[model samples]
Target: MQTFTSYDGTTIAYRVWEAPADAPTVVLHHGFASSATGNWVVTGVVDALTAAGRRVVAIDARGHGDSQKHHDPAYYGEDAMARDLVGLFDLLGLDRVDLVGYSMGGVVALVTAAAGRRVRRLVVGGIGASAAEQGGVDRNSLVGAALIEALLTDDPSSISDERALGFRMFAEATGADRKSLAAQARASRHTPIGLARIKVPALVLAGVDDWLATRPHVLSSALPDGRCKVLAGDHLTVVRNPEFAAAIVAFLAD
Candidate 1:
């Protein structure tokens, strides 16, 4: 329940779990419409990393989770969100850190890592570089946004039962308004910039059945030193798969 002030004076909240002072630090960014706890902590990802002797820093991005939310849609841009991470590192006195970002958080990680050498290593799952190169608004993002709007309006019948349930789970975890979340998703979405600048080791992972980020798009040649791996399930389930965690642990350890 620790809080740090972003550059714009917005209070950002993060939970820190550690094994020792010298343990490698891994900062996790949850997906769009999800909080740090719901997306990772409750999923046992943070616990796994901690048990493996890695320090974990999980943050609730602005307008998501326990952090302060702004009504301005412009504030949700990826560059601004990436800047918030840089501010968090400065506030905590961390020189550099490894990053694990899922879904929308993956976009922020790509932006942050591309900005400079702040990241030691990066693992991006449940997302791809298509949005980063294709101006962010893809068919999937548009569909995802429309579904969120329907849920926010309490029109559950507008979406499939399973899809509605998924949105409900995310809503409960992040406390983000459906319309606002969708607007943010549309606004913050963009292609990854400064890709040629990233020199750190990177692992780009996607679920075999993930509708949001498909296989060929994620495995494209744009990413510098980027490597891709496919997991066994869809978005949410793949994040918790044993093989997924093993891949991350092995990459970070290397």
Candidate 2:
């Protein structure tokens, strides 16, 4: 529940779980419509990382979670989101750190990491480059909008239960704004040029059942220095899976 000011003077929110002083710091960026607490803390991912002696910094991206919400769709671009990360690091006085991003956050990490040398190691889960290549028009475009509309019904309880508790949590945390959420999705839908510029060690993880980031299409050619891991489950379930977390830890440790 800490806050920092971005370059644009937007008050960004982040939660830090400190481990041993010597442990490597890892930053977690949640997907669209997800907050640090809902996506990582509530799911026990932040706790797991801290218990394993890693300092975890999880952020609530602009227009989502507890961060400042600019209704302007223009502020949701990948470079803009990436600048937020850079602003966070600058605000915290961090030189370099490992980064783990899911969904839209993954695209931000990719663009950020590609643009500079600040990331030590990177793990991208539940998304791929195609979503970026497609200019952010993934299945979520249809599904997310539908889900948002469902939330505005007389009783959102039915819609909340459809994707298990995770979707419900996401819907509640985002305030169920379809236009702003979709704008964020659209903002993340394009890949930045120059993949070969990114020289950092990277791991790209995609869920086998994730329709948004299909295996053969997105993972294969995403990063110039990227390694791929295909796990079992859909996008939501994959982030919390113990095996998936372990893989991320192992990659960062290497």
Candidate 3:
């Protein structure tokens, strides 16, 4: 568990699995409320990337995993997350990398790519362009609030929404810091952005049934060099799919 200090003095944690020195390195960003281990390592993403002869650098976003956790909403934003990645790259001396991000991490990747970071290839999953355009309370804010309420009150009965309740339960089950996650949710909002600045080849992938990331083709079309692909299962299950790993390996290899 390697650690680096972000520009804002936030401690960030990351793990590097080395491959051949000449092989292209891939940096992975996990979804909302998930750690690098939960989203990438445990899901076999690290193994697949390593097996394909690629070096892997997996990050635990602020307020998730072993990284520094903050309950202040000021600590999180799409730009903040992007800055964290940039700091990680600078700390590790990574000149360029293939960036793979899922869900909330996908938004961070887009922000980073748009900011002219050294991303050679971008693979975004469980998100769409509409997400990049929309501005409002995110889908997870309610869940975060519910989790916060439950955590503060120590009573699950306070949450009314079933989806929010489930999220709270999952967070509790996973031993997550509910306050920090809730703060993250409150701070994160998808603001409209132009994708024309991103010149790298990108692969937009998601589950066919993922309503949260509707119309991935729209996102792909926005990119100068982008394409979309759908796999079986919903957003949650698709991460466990072997095809997901295979597609990424093939795309990067190409």
- lDDT for each candidate structure: 0.75, 0.72, 0.82
Q: Global CA lDDT of candidate 1, please?
A: 0.75
Kindly list the per-residue Cα lDDT of model 3 for residues 6-109, writing each as its tens digit.
Answer: 99999999999988857558999988778899889888988999998899999999999999999998998778989999998888888988999998888888
Q: State how far residue 113 of model 2 sits from its true place (Å).
A: 0.2
Deviation (Å) of 26 in candidate 3: 0.3
Give lDDT tens digits, candidate 1, residues 1-254.
98888888878899998668474589998887888987787777887787778988989888877888776677677677788899888877778899998877887888888886779998888876564566342445436555556546665555654654576656755567665565565576555476667778888888888876775244334567778888887877888787877888788878
For lDDT, the strongest prediction is: 3
Model 3 stretches astray by more than 4 angstroms: 135-153
TM-score of each: 0.88, 0.83, 0.92
Error of 2 at 77 (Å): 2.1
Off by over 4 Å in 2: 21-23, 129-132, 135-170, 173-179, 191-193, 216-220
Q: What is the C-alpha RMSD of each candidate to the true structure, in Å?
A: 2.7, 3.7, 2.2
- Candidate 2, residues 1-254, lDDT tens digits: the string is 99988888878899888777574589999886777876687767777777778988998888878888776668787678789999988888788889988877877787778788889888877666564465342554345555444534555655543542354456665575545565665455454445667778888888888765665235536566778888887877777777777887788877
Scored by TM-score, the top model is 3
Candidate 2 lDDT trough over 10 residues, lowest sum? 135-144
